[model samples]
Target: MDSDTFVYTTYIRTTPEELWKALTDPGLTRRYWGVAFETDWSPGAPMVWEEGGRRTADPGQVVLAAEPGRLLSYTWHTFTPAWADAVGLGHEVYEGLAAEPRSRVDFAIEPSGDTVRLTVTHGGLAPDGTIKELIGEGWPAIVSSLKSLLETGEELPEPPR
Candidate 1:
């Protein structure tokens, strides 16, 4: 609700159930998000982030809320050395991000005239926060890729090296 919060919305030509699946299903998520989560979708359950054959999660990263096909909220990820190495981020920068207060992301899904509106609100971001900026930079591409994958049955081309 504040400037520290980042909200992204995209309308996918799909059902709310499908959009929810894309947000919660590990396999589906990995296809578009480049990351998969391990969680039971319970409010208090832990959400582990796995990607590129590396897994990283911490106590601070857990499901804040879950309602299938309607809403899902979870604490943001933990930055680890393996994650930094895999993502090409410097370890020091990773540490700096890790030191910041953990943020949370909430996904709200709604039916909208043959399409589903998916809104992602990422909050707890401090002004000029490193992790905030990182997530803000990342969400647009992530959301667009998700839309493409759901609509076209295929993901967009990989970024150039």
Candidate 2:
């Protein structure tokens, strides 16, 4: 990953409007994300989620926000309860990347007239072998599952052990 940016892109066989709803609507996201993404479409609004009793909401503000078909960008930190108080894995990681000291998450959507191209960029990941390995292999599966849900309205099977 020479890019220093972890990104995943997929072209869904659906309109931007449909995918927008799938991304922003908590009810619809649950159909694909398997958990509700609690957020209101307002700049600086907080976004968060809980799955299987685990909270995954990074503490930050919604920096870039556009409607329907453009982009959603936000500041993020890996601050789940599991990471709390864990040295060498908290704000230091975020600070090491840049001065902003927060992870950047981007959801960019491009309209192809017949489909929506979705790109997810998750920056500020720990530059470690295990973490990179997991994310590299896992994101594609998740994106493929997102495609399956958007196209066929079916959730992907549970992740393997």
Candidate 3:
């Protein structure tokens, strides 16, 4: 209920290890989310984001936590002009995003009987900010696609940009 944070939870018919792989594997993430992260996934390891054929890297974009099959957290990528252009964001919108403080996202995976419970928490956002508003619409679709891919071996259709 915090305006500065966004949280989404879903149950998937899969094991925690498998779910963790799907979240961390570049191939799996690209298939479901069109974003592939290049990182060792260890705590404090730097991460490079690949999306739409563009790579975004920064020293601050490092993994905050990496407990395989249990928890994963990282600071969000820096908003660059190239990335904004690749994603079709307008100049003004991009400027607004660049001005906001960077956010972090955490994924908690827990075993639940025959399924795993996946909870994604994105925090450090400004209340009712542009990035917050954008992710408010993005996380659900991304999580749903992730669920469908693990359950059916196929992801949902590409979402509109």
Query: Model-by-model lDDT, in order?
Result: 0.87, 0.67, 0.95
Residue-by-residue lDDT tens digits, candidate 3, 116-148? 999999999988689998899899999999999
For model 2, how does the per-residue alpha-carbon lDDT over 49-78 read when each residue is reduced to its tens digit? Answer: 655455566556454565567887766534
The predictions' CA RMSDs to the true structure, in order, are: 1.7, 4.8, 1.0
lDDT of 2: 0.67
Top candidate, metric lDDT: 3
Tell me the lDDT of candidate 3: 0.95
Q: Give stretches of model 1 more than 4 Å off.
A: none
Q: Which of the two candidates, 1 or 2, achieves a greater TM-score against the reference? A: 1
On a 0 to 100 scale, what is the lDDT of residue 105 in model 3? 100
Q: What's each prediction's TM-score?
A: 0.94, 0.73, 0.97
Worst 10 residues of 1 by lDDT: 152-161
Q: Which of 1 and 2 is ahead in lDDT? A: 1
lDDT of 1: 0.87
